[model samples]
Target: METNLADLPVRIFHVLSRELGRDNLWVKIVDFDQDPIFSMKQLEIDNFLKRDNCCDQVLRRWGNRGQTVGDLLRRLQLLSRTYENEFDSIQLQLRRKFKILRWVPDSEEQVTMAVDEETIKLECKAQGFPCPTIKWYTNDSKEPVHTGRSYTVLRCKCSTEHQYKCVATNEIPEGFSFSEHYKRPGKLWNSVLESDFVDITSLVRDDELCESCKNFEMGRLSQILADDEKVENKTIPVPSNLDSTLRAADKVALIMSNCSYVHLPELMTPHCDAQTLADALQKMNYKTVTLADLTLDEMRYFIREYKKLIGDGVYAVFYFVGHGFEVNGQCYLLGVDAPADAHQPQHSLSMDWLLSIFRDKQPALNLFLLDVCRKFIPYDAIGAFVEYSEQFKKFHRAHRNMVYGYSTSGGVGAYEVKGEINGVFMKYLKNHVSMEISVMSMLHGVLKDIENDPKQIH
Candidate 1:
């Protein structure tokens, strides 16, 4: 087929791109129909050739699947901790509340304490890693008079009777009603306000509900507080929310990550991340299975059999952490047996293959939390491997309500916290996910926390 551009003497060249494969070709006006007769105008052949070279360079860079050199470089930069734009912080715990203890000092009682020049030190004992911040509230004021270390020092000018209360608060995740069970969700941020420290003396006295219900809530509150303390020590058991999930018939999640690669250095945080996330999942009453340092075949076998554990009434979650790469646009997960160099495709499991298994199962929501990043993949021709937004989006579309979230967006390396046991994203996730919400809501909460990282460089 040809188009006649109004009586002009033009010749079209059938330019075939070898890089684009034999099935695809392009038509170019190489040198027009340069007839010796009629004193034809000279074709801009030099500029045309230069333009073609530029187009070829782009095609080489993007390929058929839109890969780039920067993709691989970003992975290496992250692994080596050499990103110029990346920020460093000794502080890992960003904005999130810790478990506030109902200590005697945290009582909401009205006490008239006499003030003088002798420094009155009110100590607030709370269970948090950095220790709970103690702020003194006088006369029920919203603003605190002091917030420093363990004691809020007050230099009284004269002998005055003052009603002072010590408020102990760590950053509680917004939208979670861990603070107050009765307070409604916030209109702006949707965060649940912190509940007042329980005064066991008064709470047991005012019996509003039947003995059973009150005991349950008190048990649940005790469990929540227990989790708060355990989280600080990095040892979380089946929490209060899990029992509620079991009662509600929540779905099960199978979480696993193999960071101890045979060819790579043992990662300091992936296993910790997997375990912490697993604990959170279990607290949400998910029959979660977390594994570390599995071989390629073992990973495949476990995923293959994972479908049998699911039922139609529940959802499934699969969380992966470790090195990830793509070969020819298909994503793959590396096990501990994965080689540093490309030897055989069997050494790494194709992520698409695992998702295929997930889609085959009967579940309402298939949630996959991928902590994997595109690393230096050794393909025969395609020099690099990296995750793409398109692949995840396509998977998202493959099923109805197949919710998934990554630690970082595609083509970026997830950061690591130096002293913290979990990676950057999981650290926030472990702090934010609540059993009170749906799986998607839990993940959305996690994503919100990650987006709010103060030190994040865009």
Candidate 2:
């Protein structure tokens, strides 16, 4: 939180005028320096200051008579020192940027320490005007294992290998915080930059291993196992360089989550998940259209109209959370009205068709997030699902700016705990969407979070 001397005066002046009346500030300035000529205009002295509006005029008057900005700053600092108690309170309330300085073990090095007896100590360092708090977690656990700059891990058997990660954060009055990088420690900074979840060590105790554990490590380095799903609300810093480009583009999001179904099993988290995502996107200035439980025809109708909102530089996002399946390498989203026993394209919306429509609109970014299962259909249903026509096969736009982020890989089922608010994918994604990185890079971070998550690791 090192202050920029150039802007420091303006910030200090703003607080002084609000805490003390304009008349009192003007009188104090004249008496503090005992200058023979008072340059402040009478109109400015009497002006009703609503926030910082009148500060500009007063500063302009102060600068007119052979006085530099630095001169004004020097005068302000003198006043600040004279009223130390009051100035201290005001300075404490002023905003400061938070950032991570360095990690004890740099994640980029990918150092693999093999230990069977010695304990390991891990630490992270950060600095801000108001210091940021540090928290540590093992693997994908939501709750912090330790809170502070450093943590110690005891030696464990091969059965307990795990990765450890640390995060530093501080709140801003403005709900969202800005981001910037620093060259070294103790430099003036910035956000929630995290250490790569790193494997602290690999231990192989041959005598302590079970049959399955023996086969799992088969001469290779021991890998961490298991998934745990607990929800931790964290912020991602949007870097300054990408700020303008992300904010400049027209952003529109269409969120459709179907939980109630006539033929398929009813879900518990879709409604809650959709709302959570909508709130997060809206904070980032996205125009969000959130809908639920749409039928096949309704899905088609809404999508057709949704594309109209996309223009040359628009950033269009389409998200669907519901029952879904893949067959012959093609994916389909199911509707509430889909049949129970026999499901076909007629009762679902084809992904190819969705991509084709968006490709023609020429948006700057086309992002699709599917928070549903992609397991293959039964053999009996395969023939019916593989009805792809020649047109569908030829509709490939490899050069288009499109990204598909699926919750689970093909032939795998995505899970939703009965009482959880969000599915596995959205649980990690909501924390990453606002990051000031490329769309792919943001999604890659989400992927890493998912990989570390104990519940979603499988």
Candidate 3:
């Protein structure tokens, strides 16, 4: 993690200076492990010819910062936005040399502890950009025994030793093709990383217990046995049908997909993915509006138009796919012309703004399904263009009819698997969106399906 920026390779220094500008005051040499500080520098215009693979090392070093290549490229693109004369040509040159980088969970082995007679604790250490998800499972069981970094199980003296498995995973950046040469095989850093099995011993022997304590333990054990006997007689409840008040005619959907880009890295599958979801919803009798590759002004225009379509007691869904980033804990969807380095609010649609606009519509369900990265990207400055209401901060708290379904966790990116026609989120969403069941029920099914596929572990 040690880096001396001033001592950087001559090739990398050239790339930064040339792209970020020799005198922009945004390029500096310092510790990259911390946030980069921008400063001005001047270099002699030597007759240096660029090599074919000069940027490869630059890519590797940046990727190690727990950032995808797409994120790094977007930042560079924004910082160089003022270079309008040769912008397209220079950006294209940079793009040709870059490939998308996906993050995976690098997990350590499990740490187990026998905390108490009634509880056995297991802890697994994992490290990743957004922190990996941990799930603990018993031997040969398809379902997880517990979830989180620490898991506790009820200990019984009659039980035998058992093996527990720990799994850690994080989302990968979406919508980029990877060549076979860049792919890692049989490595733990491949989306889902699992730890070695940790065995748990039986509870303390009966000889170690006093007479009074033994009697108390036996009484509790007998009660548990009685509860198990009753559980066998219990019946599984069926999912209730969709509410009678909710009609297909009362449903509406707005789907936006940004595939092409002028200032940011272009995505490959968002347009097609949006269409697939639109078609699926249409079959279920919901009114659908699907649009693709919109700029900032166009996105705002359409959102305003879509807001007029909502009515009282109606089910409204807003689905977006494309480049998105989080700043100051607030999420924004990037427009095609959103600058890489400045005026972000003017060019991007704020989720809070959207929620504020819709909360007053009194829709029966205001659901948002966002399939984008939630990475925290620091911004240089803000020039307000969009008027966001502070009331939306408590919108979710005041409304019980709102649901936000994210493709990935906060500070992590979503994935678009290579060779697939759609991103992983939309791929599974299509399977359950048309079901005639409650909205929460449908979402649960989609989550279960995604969890079952290791490759789809975003």
lDDT of 2: 0.62
Candidate lDDT (C-alpha), each: 0.49, 0.62, 0.59
TM-scores of all candidate predictions against the true structure: 0.41, 0.45, 0.43
Select the stronger candidate by TM-score from 1 and 3: 3
Q: How accurate is candidate 1 locally (lDDT)?
A: 0.49
Q: Estimate candidate 3's alpha-carbon lDDT, on a 0 to 1 scale.
A: 0.59
Point to the candidate with the largest TM-score.
Answer: 2
Error of 1 at 146 (Å): 58
Instruction: Count backbone overlaps in model 1.
Output: 10
Clashes of 2: 5
| Tens-digit per-residue lDDT, 278-316, candidate 2 | 888989877676666778887887787676556566677
lDDT of 3 by residue, 126-146 (tens): 543224567887777899868
RMSD of each: 31.9, 23.6, 26.1
Q: Looking at model 3, which ten-residue stretch has the lowest summed lDDT?
A: 40-49
